[model samples]
Target: MKMYLISDNVDTKTGMRLAGVEGVVVHEMEEIRNALDEALKDRDIGIILITEKLGKLIADKIKDIKLNYHTPLIVEIPDRHGTGRTPDSITKYVREAIGLKI
Candidate 1:
């Protein structure tokens, strides 16, 4: 399975590059839509790791993509300068999936 990283910040993009991500794309909002559209075409991409800030900015789009497509697990990871933890939206999904309250 392949992994992809997307971030708008240079530092975050650099960090993901240093981490040995085979494919990394740095994009602004307009570019992000096209990038995501192209990236989702890869059947081998099993994980899509996105920066928290960007994820929040495109939450609705992400949700729509998830509802439409079942592959390529979308994960919201904090940016390099960030705390590097799962965001609340992910946590909420996990909780709801397991029927837990927090």
Candidate 2:
């Protein structure tokens, strides 16, 4: 199984490449969708790393994929500009998951 990345910028792709992962940069919805579809078709790819910005841009589309498929698990990662997640995002997620505020 392999991991592939769909980054929003060249710098992020370059960084992932240095870490031994292959990826591409895409900015538009159609472009990202196309990249994701291509990545999903490859059985060898078990995980797909998407930049946070791109993920946010197509959250509904990605949600549908997550609901319909099990392979090529998608992950949202920060770009070279750094994390876009709120500091409390993890706490919020945990609260939602456990049905209780932390």
What does candidate 2's lDDT look like per residue over 20-40, in tens digits?
Answer: 999999988899889998998
How do the residues 1-102 of candidate 1 rate in per-residue lDDT, one tens digit apiece?
A: 878887767777777778777545555787777777777998988888877777877889899888988888888777657654556865788788998867
Q: Top lDDT: which candidate number? A: 2
Q: Give candidate 1 regions above 4 Å deviation.
A: 23-27, 83-102
- Separately for all candidates shown, the number of backbone clashes (residues 3 or more apart, or on different chains) is 0, 0
| Whole-model Cα lDDT of every candidate shown, in order | 0.77, 0.92
Q: Look at candidate 2 and give me any clashing residue pairs.
A: none
In candidate 2, how many Å is residue 48 off?
0.2
All candidates' TM-scores? Answer: 0.73, 0.94
Worst 10 residues of 1 by lDDT: 78-87
Q: Output the lDDT of residue 64, model 2.
A: 91
